[model samples]
Target: MNREAFYKLTYGLYLVSSLRGEKKNGFVSNAVFQVTSNPPQIAVVCNKDNFTSQLIKDSKLFSISVLKKDANPKLFGLFGFKTGATVDKFESVKHITAKTGAPIVVEESLAWFDCELINTFDVGTHNIFVGQIIDSDLLDSESEPFLYSYYRDVKKGKAPKNAPTFIANK
Candidate 1:
């Protein structure tokens, strides 16, 4: 069986942000999805070791920022390639604090969601945080959402090792 077949799965690029006390961090992820509509819930998967994960676990809150199709590549590098533990992820990025206290990047986001973590499932190397949407709104209806396939096929972006869909470098 070819592992490349897994690439057929559909995904969308997102920015998952959280706050722990006064500290804030966020990271790029492709494993965000809506799980239910009745209760308005969403799920986001993140590597256990990611700084953003720790913040989510501690704060029990998070915000999802849907990256726009024409988003700056530097924004990806800043959030994905760099470690928030060593640097301030929000230093240069323009964002607003949600009612949940989680920051939402308004710069490249087409929409944003503020959530309250309702449940957590431990998956190997990562945890799936199920959040009940507390608030959400469209930032820019004109801007198209950035899809994972677009990031790979058009932007030529590769997933980092910590990503759920990361294809190991051979």
Candidate 2:
């Protein structure tokens, strides 16, 4: 199969956050989607090795902040490129803890979602978690929500090694 053709599959960039004990962790992700609407469900794919993934497993909750066009690329680089085990991802970032006590990103967010994990499917290198929406709100109206295509074509963003889109031969 031509995996690059999967590039046709669109995604929106987001700051996905969760907590374990007193430790909060977040990372950049584009693999999020709505699995259902009646009960309002979403599926988020995360690498099993990610610290944020570990936090999600422990906390059983997560927050997704949809990134805006004006959002700082540095924030994305920090969350997407740098590993939280080596550095504090939230040190320089401004955030607010939600009703779920999950941190939500305020910088350049178009919308946000706080979810409670309901199910999990182990998929080798990645784990797919399905959750029910606990909290959700829109942030911006005038500006557009930045698309993954824009991140690549406009910002020249490169897919990280752990990203689902990472291609072995490019």
Candidate 3:
């Protein structure tokens, strides 16, 4: 099977964040999708080793910042490349705590969602966290959402090893 076929699937770039007590963390992710509309449910796939994943599991809540097309690459570098285990990602970033106590990244975000985790599924190396939308807001109606394709083609971004889209060296 050709793994390249998966590239055809569209995805949006986002910052998925959660708080473990007073400690907050976030990471860049692309494997997020709306699973239901009636009850307003969304699912985000996170690697088991990710610090943000543990925070979500502990807090049972998360926030999603829909990144804008023009978002700064440095923000992605900070969250995607650096480990939150050592770096204080939120120290310099401008964000606010959502109603669910999840950190919501404000800069260069077109929209945001605060979610209450409803269910979780272990999928090998990743966990799928399904959440009910508790709160949502549009930050920039005019800006277009950042797409995974754009990240790769325009920004020359590559998915981290833990990312669902990551293709290992063969």
Backbone collisions counted per model: 0, 0, 0
The residue pairs in collision within model 2 are: none
TM-score of 2: 0.95
Residues 31-142, model 3: lDDT tens digits: 9999999899999999999998889998899999999996898988998988789989999999988999889999989999999999999999999999999999998899
The alpha-carbon lDDT assigned to residue 86 of candidate 1 equals: 95
lDDT of each: 0.93, 0.87, 0.92
Local accuracy of candidate 1 as per-residue lDDT tens digits, 1-170: 89889889999899999999888889999999999999999999999989899999999999999999969998899999887899999999999999998999888889999999999999989999999999999989887899999999887898888998887882
Candidate 1 Cα outliers beyond 4 Å, as residue runs: none
Please report the candidate that would top lDDT against the real structure. 1
Candidate 1 Cα RMSD after full superposition onto the native fold (Å): 0.9
Worst 10 residues of 3 by lDDT: 161-170
> In model 2, which runs have C-alpha deviations exceeding 4 angstroms?
none
lDDT of 1 at 3: 85
Ranked candidates (lDDT, high to low) = 1, 3, 2
TM-score of 1: 0.97
